[model samples]
Target: MKISKQLNKLKNLNVEAEKCSTREEAKKIINKANKAQSKINK
Candidate 1:
């Protein structure tokens, strides 16, 4: 995937994480974002 697209997804994940009420939900989003960031780094 493109870097820009990955970045956008990461940004969205961060927003979702911030809005999430549960710690588990936020952790999941953060994990997803971290994976996306790793993919971008590759």
Candidate 2:
């Protein structure tokens, strides 16, 4: 259940990243999502 929630959060982050107008902003969001994903994997 927690994992699913985290996945949903990641999905939202992806969406947010897509909406970002700047490459730097998008990169930041993607990096944040990647960190969250790594935590989930562990």
Candidate 3:
């Protein structure tokens, strides 16, 4: 329950981070999101 809540929070935070208009900002966001997803899968 706690981990799932954290994951959902991460997803919402990532969504907000992804709204940045700069390429650098978006790249960082994508990388962070991928890492989070990988962690979740493991």
Candidate 4:
């Protein structure tokens, strides 16, 4: 949570990539998100 909060300090960072219009793109985003969450949970 603290690491994520610090990342929020970056003004250009886009945490919510909600503009995915393709299935492939969406899958890539979902996979990346899961990977990140797993790392944080560990």
Error of 1 at 35 (Å): 0.8
Residue lDDT tens for model 4, 5-42: 43343222234456667788767766666655565666
What ranges in model 2 sit over 4 Å off? none
lDDT of each: 0.91, 0.86, 0.74, 0.55
**Global fold similarity of model 1 (TM-score):** 0.85
TM-score of each: 0.85, 0.75, 0.64, 0.60
Tens-digit per-residue lDDT, 1-42, candidate 1: 899999999989978987899989978998899999998999
lDDT digits (tens) for residues 3-35 of candidate 3? 686598677767778588988888877777776
Write the candidate numbers in order of decreasing lDDT: 1, 2, 3, 4
Q: Which is better, 1 or 4, measured by TM-score?
A: 1
Cα lDDT tens digits, model 2, 1-42, are 478877988999988987899989988998989878987897
Give each prediction's root-mean-square deviation over alpha carbons. Answer: 0.8, 1.7, 2.7, 4.7
Error of 3 at 13 (Å): 3.7
Q: Which residue pairs does candidate 3 place in steric collision?
A: none
User: Which model is ahead, 3 or 4, in terms of lDDT?
Assistant: 3
